[model samples]
Target: MATQNARKQDPQEALIDDLRDVLADTEAMIDDVTAQGGEKALALRGKIADNLRAVRSRLYDAEQKVAGKAKEAARATDTYVHDHPWQSVGVAAGVGFLLGLLVSRR
Candidate 1:
């Protein structure tokens, strides 16, 4: 069950997870660079900081977009079910039947 849930995660969740890994790596690199005292290192650190900020901004925007799309999809589904309750139930039953058949085959 846990593995199934993990596999069913939304694309946005996957993206956020990957970005978090990248951010952690960048922070570790920054820490390592701090030990080296030199003008070049300082410049490199500044560049890295700028890149980190840009990536953070992009991640935030992507999160918002994904949230918006999810909300929109939910709203559409709600409206459809409300407008055609019987049809929705029929569709749900058909899907369940198909799933049961597939599972029984295994």
Candidate 2:
């Protein structure tokens, strides 16, 4: 139960950390933009914006990849059950019977 709860919270904690880093980077970028002048500042600003956009795109792609992997896992599980229905059932029954026996012994 504790492990499951931790796993559920882990992504949110990681996202918060990532946001903190991005915020720090943005603050630094702002300082850099202020330090430069005229055309240089503008160019730097543009580059910073482009980099932020690229980071956003990469984050989205990574999320899509994770989702795809989860879907693939679900499909693979489904395929396995379909291909080995009797084997899967037998294994499950065997495990349940062994657990029951252990409990009875206890």
Q: Which candidate leads in TM-score? A: 1
Quote the lDDT for 23 in model 2: 56
Give the per-residue lDDT digits (tens) of candidate 1, residues 1-106: 6346447888677777678779889988987897886998889899999999999998999888988999999999999999999999999999999999999999
Highest-scoring model, lDDT:
1
Name the weakest run of 10 consecutive residues (lDDT summed) in model 2: 12-21
lDDT, candidate 1, equals 0.88
Per-residue CA lDDT of model 2 for 4-52, tens digit only, reads: 6546764744564465478568868767787877887888787887877
Query: lDDT for each of the candidates?
Result: 0.88, 0.76
**lDDT, residue 52, candidate 2:** 77
